[model samples]
Structures are given as structure tokens and as C-alpha cells.
Target: MRLIELYKSVQGESSFTGVPCIFVRFAGCNLRCSWCDSTYTFQGGKPFTEDEVVAQIEALQPCPLIEFTGGEPMLHERELLPLMQRLLRDESRRYTLMMETSGERPLGEVPTEVHKIVDVKCPGSGSAFGSFRMSNLDALTSRDEVKFVLRDRRDYEFARDFIREHLQGKVAEGTLGGILLSPAFHQSPSPLRTADNMELDARDLVSWMLEDGLPARLSLQIHKFVWEPQKKGV
Candidate 1:
């Protein structure tokens, strides 16, 4: 596998926020979102075999949660599937695998046991809108989550409409885990300049959600508050 940094940190997003988890960050990405924070992963990272990756995780004793993040982890599904299977099959380890993807890739290959967090890129991401695979919506279960990173009112509205059109009913029916709304964190080279609106604060997003009565959880990147925003390996 083309491995990036593998380390233990508190999960900063998704339903597992604030939970201690081991992160397996894979190198390389297919899209270049203007607000991407982990551009470091887009290029070089040390290589590690599947066994070596498992060994490193095993060394992080007592952590029951594991997240496979990226540079788009789904891009490595062929390599990641077996690793997840091996970890799940280990009787001594009680690891709950989580895979975070951009939602641009197909989720059909991912295992049902894994908690998949699919990010439906808002226009603020500067990635083409509607790039998400709509089929993945049917693939979701109560254990999976959908995230939308908002940059402004337009982005919020885009997410709101998407939820209303696709996810709201399923979420209400309890078939989907739930939707997440996060304010797009500004990074170096500034996506704010490119995004349609000015800078947005968490309060801005909250106000929009309140007025619209959107059915989603407001999430902040907890790790950034806990550590330096530019820090690597959380």
C-alpha cells in the first residue's frame, strides 16, 4: 500500500468525533479541492506492505477505533479491503474500521461492517458540484454518515437542497445514519478568495441551519482547535 502517516489521534470529524482512533492516511488524491488541508498527502509518502501497516496499528495498543482517511482512501480500495478484512478477523483486536471518502468514488466495493463517511462536496470546495456518486446514497446504512462542508449561504443552500431532495426522508426514516454540516476550514492559499462568499464562521453556518431547520449535525474540526492547524499527523 502507498502509506502516508499512520498515527493515533482523536477523530476530529464524523460521528466518532473526539474518540481516540488510529488513522491510516493513504497518499495520493484524484481531486484538488481548493480548501484541501492535507495537500501533503497528494504526493510522496513512505511505502509500507499490508502486514507492516497492520503491525503499526497493533502497536497502538488499546485503541478500538480505526479510520482510513486520505488523499482519498477509496482510491486504494483494492489494497484497503483486505487490510480491513484482516483486522476485522483478528479475534484479539476489537477494531471498528471507518473509511472517509470524497463520495466521488463508488462505495459498492466497501464492506458493510465499515463505517463509511462520504463527503458530498459543496460548491465551496471548488470541486465540480454534483461530482458525487448518487448511487452511494442507496449503499448507505445507519452506520454510515454523509458530510457537507459549507463555505457560505450558497453552499449551505446547495447542501440543504441536496438533503431535502435526497437525504431528508431517509434520515427521518432512520435508514441513514445522519447528515453532517461543517464550516469549510480555511487553509493556506485561501479557498475563501475563490469561494463565492466572504469568510464564514461556525456561527454563520449555525444561523443558516437554524433558519432553514436543516436536519443535520453541526460539526467543527475538533483536532484543529486541539492542535496547530498546520500540524501533520494530528
Candidate 2:
């Protein structure tokens, strides 16, 4: 597998926020989101085999939660399947395997045991609007989560309508996991303040959700607040 960096850190978003987890960030992404913070993962990274990756995770004492994140983890489905299988089969310790994937790829190859957190990119991401795989929605179970990173009010409304059209019923029925709405974080300071360059304020997002009665939880990048926002290998 082409590995970027593997380290232990508190999960920064989703329902798992604030929990200590080991992250396996793979290198390379298919989408070029303007607000992307991990651009370094798009290029060079050290390669490691499945066994080597597992060994490194095993070294993290008392760590039970594992997240397979990426430039886009679903890009390496072939390599990830066996690694996830090995982790699931291990009897010495129980591990919770979670995958963070852009909803652009087919998710059929991933095991049901692994919890998936799929990102549905908004227009503010600079990617083509409505590029997400609608089929991925059917693939989700109650254990999985859908995340939307809002860059502005438009992005928030887009996400809101998407949920109303696709996710609200399922979420209410207990078939789909909860929805997560997060404000996009700015990677660097800008001289001029603009919606495109500035980080979306979480308070504003929260107020909008409350006013609209959106059925989603507010997610913030807790790790960014704890460490330098641009730091890699967190």
C-alpha cells in the first residue's frame, strides 16, 4: 500500500469526535477540493505492505479504534480489503475499523463490519456539483455516517436539501446513520477576508441548523484546534 503517514490522534470529527484513534492516511486523492488541507498526501509517500502497516498499528498500545483515511481510501480497495480482513479476524484484540472515503467511488468491496464515513462534496469544494455516487447512499447502514463539509450558506442549503431529499427518511427510520455537517477549515491565513478564503464560522453554521431544524450534528475539526492546522502526521 502507498502509505502517507500513520499516527495516533483523537478523532476530529463525526460521531467519534474526541476519541483516541489510530489513523492510516493513504496517499493520493482523485478530487481537488479547494479547501483541502491534506494536499501533501497527493504526491510522494513511503510505501508499506499490509503486514508492516498492521505491525505499526499493533505498536500503539491500548489503541482499539482504527480509521483508514486518505487522499481517498476507496482508491485502494484491493489493498485495503485484506488489511481490514486481517484486523477483523484478529482474536487477540478487538478493533473497530472505520473508513473515511469520498463518495465518488463504489463502496461494494468494503466489508460490512467496517464503519464507513462517506463525504458528499459540496459545490464550495470546487469539484463538480452533484458528483457523488448515489448508489453509495444505498450502501450505507445504520453504522455508517454521511458527512457534508459546508463552505458557505449555499453549500449548507445544498447539503440541507440533499438530506431532505435522500437521507432524512432513512435517518428517521433508523436505516441510515446520522448526518454530519462541518464548516470547512481554512488551510492558511489570507490577507483579504472572503467567503472563498476564510474558514466558515461554526457558530453561524450551528445557528442555521437550529433555525432550519436540520437533522444533523455539527462537526468541527477538533485536531486542528489542538495542533497546528497545517501540521502533517498528526
lDDT of 2 by residue, 11-49 (tens): 988888999999999999988988888888898888899
**Model 2 ranges with Cα > 4 A deviation:** 190-198
Top model number, TM-score: 2
Q: RMSD of each candidate?
A: 3.4, 2.7
The per-model lDDT (C-alpha) reads 0.86, 0.87
User: What's the lDDT of the predicted structure labeled candidate 2?
Assistant: 0.87
Clashing pairs in 1: none
TM-score, every prediction: 0.93, 0.94
The TM-score measured for candidate 1 stands at 0.93
Compose the digit string of candidate 1's lDDT tens values, residues 1-234. Answer: 798899998999888999999999999999887778888899998888998998999899799899999999988888999999999888888789999899899998788889999899888888546689999898999899899887788988899999999999988999889899987766753323332222567777888889989889988877766766667898
